[model samples]
Target: MGSATSSRSRASWLALLSAFTAGVGLGFLAHEYREVIVANPGIIGLTLLVVFAAGYLIRLAVRALRRAGSRVDTILAEELEKKPSPRPR
Candidate 1:
């Protein structure tokens, strides 16, 4: 049990470190290409559009899933209520 917990903790730390390193590398690249990025207006607009579209799609999916979950909960509750209680011996 102790070993398993330690392994999970180590994995989590490694994953976080990897993500941080990647972010720093990306930051450097973005800084290096700042001039080129600024020169392309279309790229910025397209990026923003894609981001907004993705967010909208995710929102719709979450809403649909929540609705379905609520319906299931309601059905389950109704079925449980309809069940007759056992009589005392």
Candidate 2:
């Protein structure tokens, strides 16, 4: 379980790094193509819609993970409470 958690953590960091790199690349692309992008109002609107939708989905996923983590912690605490403690010598 510890290893699994570590792996997940590593994956998350990698994902975050990848996202940052992608954002930087996209920024450069936009900078280079500013005129083209500006010329297409429809493209701007579509990109905005997609960005908002992705943001909304990411928000929902984060909320769900937090709720799940809290529920797991509560269950683990309850289970621990139910277990008898070792007797003192």
Candidate 3:
């Protein structure tokens, strides 16, 4: 369980890092293609719209994971409650 928690934490960190990297790369690419992007405002606007959607999805997924984690904790606590208590010495 400790390992599982650690893995999840690592995965979450990696995801955040990946998102940041992607955003940086995209920004650089946009800047490099500034002239073309400006000439075709529709294309640039569409691309940005897609990026915004991806960001929204990422936020939704993170929120869902947090909510699920709390539910898992509640379930684990309930299961532990059903176990017999240790006998007195």
Candidate 4:
């Protein structure tokens, strides 16, 4: 149980770190492209909008996958619980 908890905590931390890293990378990329973005304000604005929308979609996908995994886990646990335990000799 303790190991499971620790592993979960580690996974949570790793996820957080990955999110932060991705955000930072995106920010850096945006900064690097600021000049080009500024030159074509209309296109830049559209691109930014697309990026935001893509991020939202990605977030939704991640959430859906997590929900699906959790549901599967719950169903498996329920099925396992319905099984009788083996008697000790």
Candidate 5:
């Protein structure tokens, strides 16, 4: 249990680190290629929009899956309750 919790936190920490690295890399690119980025503002906007949309879609899919899993768990529990216990021979 402790390891599971620690791993979950570690995953979140890694995500944060990755996001930070990406932000720094993008900032560096924007600084270095300011002319190119400024010239194609539409491309950058579209890329950001796509990234946000994909993240939202993934979040929705995960939520739906979790709901379905819980429903299956409940259904299985109810079915189990309806069954009789076996007698010892």
Candidate 6:
């Protein structure tokens, strides 16, 4: 059960990374071929592409920050565990 939980979290991380990478790549392609995309798909397609790319990037950033917060929390917990509590004067 523990291993399964661990694997699930790892898989989610991998998926997030893949999504962020793909978003960046697609966004670059869209920018590069902006005129063609606009011509064929028009305003709607371009808007959707931009929104998805931005949203993915934002999600990646937020995930990274959350991970960092958890790490910091774990470190603090460990330190608290190691230290003795103060006594009344």
Task: Assess each prediction's global lDDT (C-alpha) against the native.
Answer: 0.91, 0.95, 0.93, 0.92, 0.94, 0.91
* Candidate 2 vs 6: which has more TM-score: 2
* lDDT leaderboard ranking: 2, 5, 3, 4, 1, 6
lDDT tens digits, residue span 1-89, model 1:
89979998998999899979988997898899999888998988898799889979998998999799999999999999998888765
Residues 3-88, candidate 3, lDDT per residue (tens digit)?
98999999999999998999899899988988988899997789879988998999999899999999999999999999888986
lDDT of 4 by residue, 25-61 (tens): 9899879998876688998778879999998999899
**Residue 21 miss distance in model 3 (angstroms):** 4.7
Model 3, which residues run further than 4 Å from truth?
1-24, 86-89
For candidate 3, the per-residue lDDT at 72 reads 100
lDDT of 6 by residue, 1-89 (tens): 89979998999999999989998998999899988887787676778899989989998999999899999999999999998769765
TM-score of 6: 0.49
> What does the lDDT come to for candidate 2?
0.95
**Cα RMSD for candidates in order:** 7.3, 4.4, 3.9, 3.4, 2.8, 8.4
The local lDDT score (0 to 100) that residue 53 gets in candidate 6 is: 100
lDDT of 2 by residue, 1-89 (tens): 99989998998999999999989999999999999998998989998899989989998999999899999999999999998889865
Quote the lDDT for 36 in model 3.
Answer: 86
What's the TM-score of every candidate structure? 0.60, 0.64, 0.64, 0.63, 0.71, 0.49
**Which candidate would rank higher by lDDT, 2 or 3?**
2
Q: What TM-score does candidate 2 reach?
A: 0.64
